[model samples]
Target: MPYFRPIALALCAFALAVPVAAQEVNVYSYREPALIQPLMDGFTEQTGIAVNVAFLNKGMIERLRAEGRRSPADLVFTTDISRLHSVVSAGLTQPVTEAKLTDNIPAAYRDPGNHWFGLTVRARVIYASKARVKKGGVTSYEDLADPKWQGRICTRSGTHSYMLALTAAYLHHHGEANTLNWLKAVKANLARKPQGNDRAQVKAIWAGECDISLGNTYYMGQMLADPEQQDWASSVSIEFPVFEGAGTHVNVSGMAMTKFAPNRAEALALMAYLAAPAAQEVYASDNYEYPIAPGTQADPLVQSWGSFEADPVNLSTIAELRSEALLLTELADFDG
Candidate 1:
């Protein structure tokens, strides 16, 4: 009880001396909030900068353009190389010249012009029916077009951004003529019309509607986690096919600074934080994707799938060819 009043006053004074955190960074994200909130919480816990996110499933670029110069957005985060390139091409995003970002992310996953940075990578892989297809039946991207697999394959619409990006990567290594012919070949092999999402293709395989399908690696992780889709996830095994001499096709979930970033410094700090191993660990694990940072281990489930050599080509090159790829898909009447 001795000096109790003075001790209480001193504790109150210490509490009053602590600074309040007033800084915030606004984010416009195509990524779902539940998927990214943990990273945001971790960032705020470390730096005391609040992150405000607006989630958009579509029309992300259009929304930014409509907002124009006075836009409150400081950062844009989304999936696919195409979306990243689209924002830059529209001039809605500004270049980030941070050395910390460049040092943490690999050269292939980022914009050479520094306009965007990839946070995590997802590989385009083959899902083969374990009961029907032999282990070595499919070894390369070219095999999807082989006559032996005709009437045994399933896919989503050819024009979907995921497919378009894969088509673009195919165009990159194999050239237009081969790619076009390959597209037609794959179209001929479809067990049914391209419909639904990547997961639906796996469901088709489980129903014995198809023997093989093309999908992103994360979809397998997602399907496994879903109680309704566990059978579909168990029906197939993943095959890491390469592009002949090249490695597997990979796409990224990436970020960019908006052209009208009101909180540029905080945005950049967040971007750099995302690139570091600490944040990459949280972000990639949350999404079941491969970390862009070279040595960071993927989640145990993703790791159990084994690893393969990722194509050495920079993603910007694939983004450049997406339009041409989509045109070829239409010309081939791939879904028809």
Candidate 2:
């Protein structure tokens, strides 16, 4: 069964009573409601367009395929390049050639065909224990495999999307043979069997179970906001590890227009609004992510974590390498 949780917008209550020609947009989002509610509310307040979001934990593509031309989804909101690429590859999204979109988002962050646009960027970084790991103890992704850190790393399942994305980026920098060996070496260094979410890994560090873990940048903000997790968050410092000759590996939270959008005009308005500088600021400030719009600044808290050059390879290339990355992960029995 598809897990659908509709966000309760003020407009949603009267949506059924509104005329057929009313201005509105429907979004099928893989992101949680709390993460995007402010953006939806901002768009509605600015344009007077009713925004209805259906949060789907999984199976968004299958649900859209099942609905076919009858699907009411105007936009698809998600994180990670692979999920965005999957929607485009499934033939479920249409090309958006709006100049506002093109001008605001950099080419490296958007689909070459205009099928999707990245709103924010997050680097896959090391969360190193402040007490156990010295400053500059880890400076590169290749260092994770070094024997000196044996049984000192904590990570999520090898096949999880975040891990695979990192693995995929590794494959791009080094070919299959080297990537496989790197994976095996990293796996051998795990503190325990690959387990839990990124936050859990940080918690493990606080519990003195591991010295470092791999996670996204935004997670620190999330942890700091939660009273119980603050200590877990405080125990580690964010480390931007480079990919040998390349920069830090990064991914995005992005948006796309559905191929069968019933509210094309309204959807376009929201898309443009999101890419606008002001909206980008809101997203950055509220989510602790790096805004992708040109000249847009990230939240001060995010900036304080410092920055690094994002990997120069286009995300589409990373998406293409995901399949092979997963195959290597499984073959190595990384979880075992």
Candidate 3:
């Protein structure tokens, strides 16, 4: 998607967003509790639209299915475009016709038919021990397959959405064969069976269990920002190993409107506001996420770590590659 014009906090029409009546809207979200509350609070303040939320660990599709057209949900807030597209694929979400949303979000970041839209982005990158790994040693993602690093690499399970997303990116950039081969090679190099979340990977590094691991860019930024996590987070530096300088692989945290949303107007309104510069800035500053909106800058922590090229593949493609990635994972026999 190309850049968006600077979001003007001006008179914009949200015919679809105005309240159908005076009741609050309900939302079901898959994003972490801490990440979504800020936006929810903001929307409530601006519109007096009380929001009832169901924060879930999983099973949103099932919940929506059970709730059916009777579901009180007005919006579905989640991280990752793949997850958002999955909702679209399930026929649980409908396309939004809000002019503000159409004008704010980009085509690549949002559905071509407007089923879902990206809120923020994250880069899939390597973070290495400051004491053990050299600044320039681990430069590109492809290098994870190197034999010299055997029994030294740390990662999450292959089945995880994070690694699978990376796998899909590989398939897009290289071919399917190349991506599978890369997965197998990297799988063989595991220090321990891939088994932890991103933060756990950092702990593993600190405990001397591993030298390097995959992580999202924002996690490192968050760790460094907090004093408690600073020691470990600062000890491992974020790296961009550019393959032929093509840039690093990136991902998104996105959202979509529910198909039978009771508050479709409010849902659409909140979405438009989320893509605006103000909301974009909040995401960048508070969560270390990259704002998908054009001209919106990343947080200082991310900036201080330095910048690298990000994969431009729209997230829907990432969803398409997920099944293929899972197949590669099974063939590789990765335990985690």
Candidate 4:
């Protein structure tokens, strides 16, 4: 009897020492941690669901495929439509047909098949020198390829996803031959070889190395916030260039549920919450991005840039054309 009693007590102690797993959702993210932490904290506080994040700068799809069913990720978060499309194409994300997502996110911003949803949007705009380039000087994207602007433009590599997306949009508007010509013209106009990120182009404008460049709208906010970079930002103003008929090109930061999400219900809940006004507000104010949720306002700084018509071309159409866009860039040898 005494020996039996000791065994029972030991079992009780062991059970007490090993705590039960709490409700939580694991996230695989390409966005930086500091940018996502506040949203995660808000979700945790509101729903009592612990959120774990893994920030990956590259190879997100490969990592998920390698993990397979054992992947601990409940959701995948990424910037740029290119990456979101890659995740969907890789078959790693499950279709989510939640009304909250569908209702809040616009049709153009979410997958038609419900595979992913965009959280925020940013326009790929031109940055013209405030002093050197006159206001209304650049009204359309095609204007950048004009002979007058040759030897006065700066830009990042054409092979970059950002550039490819723009090229893809151009292809949709102007056909292959015209887009190729446009690409070659833009490349020929470069003050120097396409090198450096968007901000670096603005730095060149400040340095008088170039009078104009291409950059994203959100980066303008980032530059204005930095005292050292404010001069570069101040030297230029954003131009919402259109495709003759279509409006300005824009991209998104978005999310999706993993096909093997262990916490699907929690993941769905998180996804819905992110699409809600509260989370959209956090994304807008903190990230300086245009919220996708209808009626959700842009950050004050973003709003100050004034509104322009967004290109009405469906994002799926753009995604479908990305590969061809890359091929054209290579053919034009834009970077070379």
Backbone steric clashes in candidate 2, count = 0
lDDT of each: 0.93, 0.93, 0.80, 0.92
Which digits, one per residue and each the tens of the lDDT, describe model 2 over residues 1-336? 133334445458679768677799999998888888898998999889999999998999999999999999999999889999999999999999999999999998999999999988999999999999997789999999999989999999999999999999999999999999999999888989999999999999999999999999999999999999999999999999999998999999999999999999999999999999889888767778899887989888999998899999889889989999999999999999
Task: Show where candidate 2 strays beyond 4 Å.
Answer: 1-20
Off by over 4 Å in 3: 1-21, 225-228, 243-245
* Candidate 3 residue lDDT tens string, 74-129: 88888776688788999999887877776666676788778888877778888798
RMSD of 2: 8.8
lDDT of 4 by residue, 1-336 (tens): 987998999999999999988999999999998998999999999999999999999999999999999999999999999999999999999999989999999999999899989998999998999999998788899998999998999999998999999999999999999999999999889999999999999999999999989888999999999999999999998888888987999999999999899999999999999999778878867878899787888877799987888998878779889999999999999999
**What TM-score against the true fold does each predicted structure earn?**
0.93, 0.93, 0.88, 0.94
Prediction RMSDs, each to the true structure: 7.0, 8.8, 10.4, 2.8
Give the alpha carbon lDDT tens digit for every residue of 114-214 in model 1.
Answer: 99999999999999999999886789999899999989999999999999999999999999999999999999999999999999999999999999999
Clash numbers, per candidate:
0, 0, 4, 0
Clashing pairs in 1: none
